[model samples]
Target: MPPRQQAQPFAKDERVLCFHHEMLYEAKILDIQPSEGSEGGYQYKVHYKGWKNTWDDWVPADRIRKFTEQNKELAAQLHAQIKHLQKSSAKVPKKGGRATGTDSARVSEERSSGAVAGSRGPRRARDYDLEQEDGFHARPSIKLPVPDHIKGILVDDWENITKNNQLVPLPHPHPVDQIINDYLEEERQNREPNSAHFDILEETMAGLKEYFEKALSRILLYRFERPQYHEIRKLWDQAGDDGPNKTACDTYGAEHLARLLVSLPELVAQTTMDQQSVARLREELVKFTTWLGKNAKNYFVSEYETPSQKYIDHARSF
Candidate 1:
């Protein structure tokens, strides 16, 4: 005879704390379903509080706990631990004005090991591409140094779209792909043609292009930008070129790309890469983001354009 089904502990719309990596986030249970696994438990669809809808996902019972004062205290403790780890990792010593690959790798390894050992549950290997996946997970505990001016740009970008009802003009003068290529060209001029640094730079830029294209429609845009996204999709469809070749990278500019950079920590946390690989990727990302900040004036538009009344009406109709 089959094993009896286990009773469900959570109900739909219930508020709870769900574990993602070593941290606990407040979440609301959206739906519940019986587990199909040999173990006869249930799964819950959770919407993480304050996160985008794209981050909502189904999690097993083991990853969730009741939302009580105790759990809240636990969550705060975990958050503090995470912050401490990030601070520790960020202190890698510099060699010749740049972090030595060895030191960075060692720091990342220590951090990763500590997180795993201290986590509340076993880390599951996800069967999805890190580049394309979404939802909360263990983020590689590293921080990117975005400049103060660039932070101001992010604030303005948010205000323009969600508050002012403005839109970034399409076919931006400096598209994401162009900005990446320009950075690559600048790097190549200083490095040997066939050197390891140049090769990694090329591969990293290529990955960034692909990642920007995939992540834009998935997690990069806010709800206010959905109408613009659909419009872009319609144009691409009408042109009879819909596929990998037609992508946001060729149309969106540095503003959107900056959004992607800011979101990278969450995205990178979902990957199954080893500490060293994660560290290396972090280094490359830091270099590119720093370059992007320097060229912000040239790449980012001075002002966002206000959408036409007709366009706004059409968007609202959707």
Candidate 2:
């Protein structure tokens, strides 16, 4: 028999409040996707309690909180208290703001009465969730730990990309550009002048530069420019001999490189004029991947899941 699916935190038909588009709406769990990584790693598809199909979508487990009547009452009571406080304060004269002894006693009595009146029913999941949400809402809008200069970069260069009202961090163009340039110069000198080999080498070098640079820019913009890449700052940080854990940006860079290396033949088939050029480009791709794998195992490519089968095949081929 097939192995049993891992258990999920929330089950189907459970009432929840989902955070979507920065707003919380009542919803119900329709399905659960078990974690492929660790516990508490489930994703859920939910239908908003009163909305149409358009508003229905999958949300992360953390983004969906249990909706309870007790919590609802607590929220209502909190709002009512705030309203009461506002009204009581407004009654004080602007010229002489000190509260009279009678006024103070009356306000205290009202507060005590309100608390006693609303203190009913057992505590629910909503109570705990609301407490957490209060802290979450109190924090500054931007969640990423990026600096002002980084924010400047986002505003000036990456005006289009942002998440949670904050700028996503950019990935560093490490060793990739340097490796390609250094190889190009070394190969250029080593090639025989006025020969077909030299011509192929030059053409392949140009093709590889255009391919990698364009691919890197697009990949960085599309993948790294998101709040999900918050750990991306670690990629820019200088580490000791035993470097820090690989960041999301690092994995992305490695994946792109690996995919590019594996897909070289297909890419070369389009732009390359001769088999000689294709062969030369593939050789360079191999060198790049080899250097990446040796020098940066954690970042470039790990035994972890890769982007495609071709990447696996190519890495094994080398």
Candidate 3:
């Protein structure tokens, strides 16, 4: 006779609290399958209660807890913590050019949530720590091989804005959208027009562009860059009816785009993407960042312009 199968703890359609990254979310068990490992276990397919179905995925048994009164309280506490974090981080600095304390936390939250200007709402928090049975796994951290030169660029960008109070001149020579298009064109040249790889490449770039446009103002800017951002907004508003459909991508350049690239791993970790999907995303991101590094001299400005006294005053007043 075949060895007896282990009994499943949770059945299909059961409401449960599912641990995703660090936070626990209310979810429903959609399906259950026996684990393939020699040690008998189960994997559950779960749909997060309020999230889109696209976020549904298989989770291991250890990640699920019964929706008891105790677990429900735990979930509520977690939700409260998320709200507190967002509220605390939402405060922008009024005087400093540097990104410090709450400013950095705000950027992390905005990037993780893909939040754009004036689009604040409840979002998932990924900062909690959870200890597992075998060992301690805090949160899912993605490692992207940002090149050494790219690391240097990030450091310079920070110092120029915070320490030097200098800014990239407006209407950059290679705006972010154009850079993305150029990368796409290069990708297309090497692949068949109808190839699946090319299709994925196009899709990935499109998503990246969307994320950049949404994230630039909310998370990519330093406290000093706020004046420049306001200027761009003012121009867009002044143009009114005749203004072209413009976004941050039309104004900012590779410098800000580089900021977004470095923060992507943290942002990606906050999502419900499966391991395979996350791996694929990391591959594409690494490729794009490498490409960006190669063209840095052309895309990035050699001399950042010093902000005028008026601009400095405006930034300080904010």
How far off is residue 3 in model 2, in Å? 75
What TM-score, over all chains together, does every model reach?
0.56, 0.27, 0.57
Model 3's TM-score against the true structure: 0.57
lDDT of 1 at 258: 84
Candidate 3: Cα lDDT at 144: 52
What is the per-residue lDDT of model 2 for residues 67-183, given as tens digits with 9 covering 90 to 100? 765334323433343344345545747785664432233234334434210111123433333433343333322111122332333233322321222222224344344455555
Clashing pairs in 3: none
Q: List the residue pairs that clash in candidate 1.
A: 139-269
Model 2, C-alpha of 71: deviation from truth (Å): 72
Per candidate, the number of residue pairs that clash is: 1, 0, 0
* lDDT-best of 2 and 3: 3
Q: What is candidate 1's CA lDDT for residue 46?
A: 92
| Alpha-carbon local distance difference test for all models | 0.69, 0.44, 0.70
lDDT of 3 at 68: 77
Against the true structure, whose lDDT is highest? Answer: 3
Show pairs that collide, candidate 2. Answer: none
The number of clashing residue pairs in model 2 is 0
lDDT of 1 by residue, 1-318 (tens): 665687677889999998664357889999998888676778899998876677778888767877977558556654554455456655766666654322233234334434210223322251222222222233454345566688888877877876788888887788998899899888687545754446777887898888888777666665556688888888777766655325688889998898778767656777677654554565567768877887889999998888888878775654
